[model samples]
Target chain A: MSHDAHVYSKSQTEYEYTRRVRREAMRGQVTTFAIMIFLTLIAFSAVAAGFSEYFIVPILLLLAAIQVVLQLYYFMHMSEKNHGMAAFFLYSGAILGFTLFLTFLTIVWWN
Target chain B: MDFNTKYTPQSWPDHPEQVTLEGKNKFLGFWLFLAGETVLFSSLFATYLALKNKGPSGMEFSTQTLFELPLVFVMTMILLTSSLTSVYAMYHMKNHNFKGMQTWLAITVILGIAFLCLEIYEFNHYVHLGFTYGQSAFSTAFFTLVGTHGLHVAIGLGWIILLLIRNAKRGFSLYNAPKYYTASLYWHFIDVVWVFIFTVVYLMGVVG
Candidate 1:
């Protein structure tokens, strides 16, 4: 069976509007990148400044969590519509992964 | 429509990557694969965390002394920038600018190569300092964890390069659009893993 994809060309104004919208989205992505860089800087500086391990470790992990969320939602487009199934699969994996972390850290350390 | 159906920017669908049955299936299936990958990496991370700094008696090497922050910092920046470049490439793809997408992807490949080079240098430096793979339990765990990530980076670079060359002659099409989109998604996932690596392994290592 053949699938026929109908092509409908946009008018000049419509094309221009779509282009502008894409450009705006790109700008937002760039801003997200900048924030990731800033977070990296703070993580590095916090360690270099010789802060208490207790204080620095949590902050570092927090920054990493924030960065990963941004990467997932923005860069990976998980924030977009029609991603319900995708989100479900990913979060399930994430929950299992978190369980693994807790098990290893607690059980292995205790033993 | 035929897989080879041609279209100008004006005729191209807004979400060309997901416009067809195959594209939609590929999109969902790839995310499932990514979810599995997350589980795989989590296991590795767990193993590394448990075995970290646990070596034979009188062992000298540890995370604090072995890792150099400056080198890791630079590598982080390069990889982060490369991720954004791939985002730019996708933006160009959405705009149906084939040349623009290719150029940005080329830039991304270059940056990826630079990151790989730094990683090689870092590994070699560690080896010279008596940190070989079989040195100790800690060394094994460290190498296994970070080396797996390095392998992922190498694989991602190869995948993107092959896509760039194979599709060099073919402009944007519904068939190939999902391919590029998935490749970028994988690349971003690599960056996500690195974020955790730097924090859990490098940063925490330094802190302790």
Candidate 2:
């Protein structure tokens, strides 16, 4: 290759270092996913078997909320660097979501 | 608290500066994606709760004959396991174990395929029993909520197929690393959605 070409490639390649390293394992996240699924299915089966109606929705609420946290921290990599910035968007979305759901719930249920 | 400590060096590139940009982007981007999913499921949940009993001609379609604990339970297992398999794929991708990554991705794909098949059968049974979408509000919400989830699975399947094919040769480059990671992220997201669906749609409906 020409000297100029080599120079250009060298500069570019400086950033082109090893791409796939060890960080992507994400085992912690995946394992959490597995456990949530297992527990959720157990709950699903139990409810399908017939349960007191009042307990079903509340228990599901707990499970769903917990799973959301797991997805955020684990799958979505929310705990990584720049998490503060990420959390800004995430918390904004969460607050907005809860507000929306609660607003609707109040309008529909309390009314 | 440092992101670097959270993962092994192999989980990322060797030259840390090369990845800082992408990691930051991903951190925000994936959260935005989750926001959108929240709206999607919330809408489905609202619609289902609203129309769960609105049947045509006063016939009042029901799910008693449509859903079975055993089949849904099986599907739940399949999808959940696929999430684990995807994690393994990501793990290998970080390690730069190209062959191992491919193997795990294939496993995830197979599990996803199995789940989709069971879901198809479940929907078929529902339709056969006159509990189809057009039959009642209940069916409409049921199909739309659950069907949306099914559609996500289908999309996920297509995603992995493309990833598997694309990465077959190139292996795990930085370019490809994020692709697989995001796909797995999506897989877990949809699986999380299913946890709700199984509860609110199948379990809650039946128990109620």
Candidate 3:
């Protein structure tokens, strides 16, 4: 309830545990950053290569999707525990957004 | 304001931002707000996709003609790097290193400003080429979708600047940890949106 309510003094075991967690997190961040940069490079190159629209479009979207996931999980820390509510709302919103996209593609644009 | 029992912890082993109750609420509420934003942006994207390239006769410009890849590419890199910088800020926040967090945040803000400036210049270039918002349906949708994103970046820049100034003297406390955390989350969300924009709008336009 208080700011100091949770004790800050950590035993050796707790300190090691925190250290390990942090090390893993740092690794994840570095790896994710590298992959995201690579993905962006691929996306740009795909367009620049002058491939057919059919070939480039799908690949671009797929790369973008992967990059977004990396951004959410690694950068935004959404993959960490205690984020169930956040993940739930995000997925729900994504589904709804997809449906909206479909409606426009199928009905609004066609008409 | 109970100073006696509210000493800053020497270590934050558990949840750093959620050490206090306010952080939990802010974290939850900010996610909900982002959910709404997801839908908000999706609707705009859908509208833009549907209406894109549907301009009336003699007014239609091919996506390749309207977009220049080099400029957009630089802007994308700027925003993406900013996202990574914010992640570093959050890492420092969890470690209870206020100076480290502020340094990374300052870097993030600078990167964000650079991106916004490039976007502005990109828009100006387009207008000079006569791709005004009222020029066509595609133009309108383009501006609305990308402009919405630009507005988010501008707002984020202002938000981070204000936080930096306001918290300069205060440093990191349980009271303000949530504020910084939520702002970083917002910045990451904007980056996520830009990823899609680059893929769907600029890349797709030029390639498709």
Candidate 4:
């Protein structure tokens, strides 16, 4: 099976173009990292500022959700092609996780 | 080609990590494992949330008095930056720049070690303050959840460091490309879990 593989060298132009594209993608990843940092700052400051728990909790969760989405899509390359099965598995786990959260938060805390 | 196949920048596949059947299977299998990790962590988070702050009748060690924001904030930034460094490493990997990739990964390992040191210090401080793992349900839950994440960080560091050493002379190949790719993905996933730990565990713990 290994012998079936073929290696094709790119032309100079093709190599340069791919390099440029990857650099741009790397730049996008940096932007995502910046946004994640901004979100973390907001989360920390909102608590440090002494906001009501009711108001802060939802905002914190929302910010965390947004940050995770960015991490998964940009950093983890879920935004790229050929991730349908990957998405399916992760989302299925996520759905079940959400269910676990709901159940535990409700049932376990009951007096 | 096989592991020993040599290629120049011009010959390197665009997605060298996914260029082979083995690489493709590894890619898919790793994601499946990550999905399982998600479920496992969610169970832990749920348990932590349900048991948070619940203890004996006169428990005084609540989240408000226990968690320190500045420390957590620093840890968060370190882990987040480490995630980006791994991204940079992957970028170099894609560009077929072996030295660049190794340098960035080394930077990532240093950051990860820094983060792990902070966590150890934080846990030691907690233990010193009578908040040992057996102190209360809250303490137990807190330690378990956060400690589990710390373990992941440790494992990730070991994995990347091993890869760096093993591939030092290997240069780049379809075989090792997928290994590096999956390791970075694991590192990013660690950062993803930290985002929640900071928000739900530390930030919200402070608010209440």
Winning candidate number (lDDT): 1
Q: What value does the lDDT take at residue A64 in candidate 4?
A: 96
- Cα RMSD, each candidate: 1.1, 6.8, 2.1, 1.0
TM-score of the first chain of model 3 = 0.84
Q: Candidate 3: misplaced stretches above 4 Å? A: A1-6, B1-9
RMSD of 3: 2.1
10 residues in a row with least lDDT, candidate 1 chain B: B1-10
Candidate 4 lDDT over residue span A1-111, tens digit each: 355757888899998999999889888888898999999898888888998889889999999999999999999999999999899989998999989988988898675
A75: Cα error in model 2, Å: 3.8
Task: List DockQ for all candidates.
Answer: 0.75, 0.24, 0.63, 0.81
Residue A66 lDDT in model 2? Answer: 83
* Candidate number achieving the greatest DockQ relative to the actual structure: 4
Off by over 4 Å in 2: A1-34, A99-111, B1-27
Docking tier of model 4: it is high
Q: Name the 10 consecutive residues with the lowest summed lDDT in model 1 chain A.
A: A1-10
Rank all candidate structures by their DockQ, best first, as comma-separated numbers.
4, 1, 3, 2
How would you encode candidate 1's per-residue C-alpha lDDT over B1-208 as one tens digit per residue?
5577888899888998888888899999999999998998998999999999889898899998899999999999999999999999999899899999999999999999999999999999999999899999899988898899999999999999999999999999988999999999999999999999999999899999
- lDDT of model 1, residue A16: 96
* lDDT by residue for model 2 (B1-208), tens: 1222233333445422225457446645876886777776776777677666657665746655456777877887787778778777766665557899899989999999999999998888777877766877678778888999999999999999998997688755545566677788788888878877877777776776
